[model samples]
Target: METQLSAARVSIRKGKAKPFWYGHPLVFSGAIQKVDGSPEAGECVDVLDQNGNRIGWGVFNPHSDYRVRLLCLAEENAPDYAIQDLVKRRLEEAVLVRRSLGLPSDETNAYRLFNSEGDRLSGLTIDCFGDVLVVASSALWVEKYRAEIEAAMRDVIKPRVIVWRQVNAPLRQDGVSEIIQTISEETVTVRELGVNYQVALGAGQKTGFYFDQRENRALIRSLAHGRSVLDVCCYTGGFALNAARGGATNVVAVDSSAPAIENAKANAALNGIEDVEFICADAIEAMQGAEGANLVVLDPPKLARTERDLHRAIPYYRELNKAALECLGTGGLLFTCSCSAAVSVDLFLEMLRDAAHDAHRRISLLKITRAAADHPLVPAFPEGDYLKCFLVAVA
Candidate 1:
């Protein structure tokens, strides 16, 4: 049965094989020359070059623009492939990668375990917060192999609870079923570099916390000491609480969501840090009226969900950075970030440049950071590197 399922062959157009050979994992719809077998969505299929030589094996999605997400590259002398075996191997590899990074280290108990395409598992993302594992499925195929995937994860991390969330992804949603494992506690207190944060898996943003910002937040310890820090759009106070713990004399956390601000305050108090102030207001408006902060962090929600929104997103990114820049004191540090996959790093930097010019401020790019080690980037898939952090010094 497995062999028959994996035997479906797809041929690529004459010049389109270049990307597949060059290590790009996605085979676009238009690149396909022909499909020898009529494969349904989420089926494993063999991808061949124009010459009919097997190039790779991937998960096929007829409805998605990315027609195939290549899971295994063909070895020069080897010609065998199995979807189940590949999945088991990839899941173990992902766990080993995180273990190599010393993740869940002494101070941190939350991090990404599987980064979808980054982990060679293109359909789903799994994150670990303390003892709970949050599984976010975006591809319909993931649901097809839910049991195997969960078993594989259990073989590795063995988390106490696994919460499933089917993100309203752009991919086909047919034949997908929810997987839920009950636990008494829906919320877990996760520790990141000594800062304790209560992550509500039952309700909150992606995976209950932005574990990608761990390293960047850790950097605040050295830069925020004695500085008046302002964390704009501070969801659950990740940065603000860390800044306070880092010995910042005063920290102000602002978010549009009252619940988020409340969570921020609770997180601050959880650590017994009193110098931080929580404010519920539109981050842009708050920053526009705010000033004198020695350190400002502008980590907003994704501005553009798709390429069509790129032009509209650019202006919003510019305006937000401009407002935040105005709030920064001379010689202050600005930790600007964007999670918009549609917004490239260069474009974000350009947005920063325009914002600096408009604010009449001189901004020095001190460092460029990215998602924590756990959210590994696949060189061939630029979209995997979605989180961008720019640490700049404003004067």
Candidate 2:
């Protein structure tokens, strides 16, 4: 058994503190110091303090103004350890959580195992598509434990393949070389709600298909039958295709990205279905010209990058919703969503209400949706709960 730290001795001071004697392999703490000997962001250092005194650890951003994001208080005489243990433990916990949710490992091959800080594993993300695993290491700690993480996946999960899509450019600023590796196979297919999706292991957005919207798409399918559906910002036509399968009379899918439109068309073709229209244009313009659509689905991408961007984004959301409402027939359904973490669900709901008023239309909120079960949220981390979907009926 590893010896646990007794208690931490922490004090706020300026300057580097020397390590005290301790009966532990590792003692670490981050210090706040500037480049020119001025007080700046703190530095994380192994505690060489005497007598095994507990040391504090935190996140330190050297470039930005704020320097230390203290994660945990240090304890005295804590065992010195490698980051490999941390990564392994986090993955185990994530796996256990998914198992508790009754998620079949074989049914839907694509899912997220670890959501960076959300999983208490900082700077690392793991996405599983069937037997293939894609890993993105964004932090130095995760980079150090990469091999251990891969080994853990092999021993525990036994994934057929693993790929490392390292973000090296930003790490270069910190003097870290990015490592891209194909640890396993080069391709994999994922099943989402009974639909088969073939994605390149090394390519595609984030982790290929967006599994976060799995449940929401199912909900849209249930409501889209016998309706004229319009899917704005329809990347790859997940919603549009599902709506078509749901027996929609006709579906119009629009996106600004040409490649996305092509992929949507391809996805439609893959399903061997017709009676769907693909438009490569701005979502707002597409919504403006949309007519005779009883159901308008607006699953726009994140518009507000930060809190400061929200003020500018609210008007855009309002305008977009207003345009959709303008073409929505009476008693029509409007499935809208805002994936921006900066935009709170309350604020988004209010924006839609205001947009309806601006368009001189009355709308009733039918239901609200969030990310699927696979994307678990930690109570301490509100950022993990970013997805918000609203099903409204325009009266």
Give me the overall lDDT of model 1: 0.83
Q: What are the clashing pairs of model 1?
A: none
Taking the tens digit of each residue's C-alpha lDDT, what string does model 1 give over 144-225? 6777677777776788988877666444343344434323348888888888888888677876788888889899877888
Off by over 4 Å in 1: 1-6, 76-81, 172-185
lDDT of each: 0.83, 0.70
lDDT of 2 at 395: 79
- Deviation in angstroms for 112 in model 1? 0.6
After the best TM-score superposition of candidate 2, give how far the Cα of residue 340 lies from its true spot, in angstroms. Answer: 1.2
List, residue by residue over 1-395, the lDDT tens digit for candidate 2: 22232322233234344321111111223442222222322233332223333344433434432233333335522223434444566678899987886655554667787776566654577888777788876655456556767887787779877888765643453335545653434755566766666666665566566778989999988988899999999887889888988999989999999988887787777778678899999988888778799999998878896799998999999999999899887889999998888999899989998999999999999999998888876564576678999999987
Worst 10 residues of 2 by lDDT: 19-28
177 Cα displacement, candidate 1 (Å): 11
> CA lDDT of 359 in candidate 1?
92
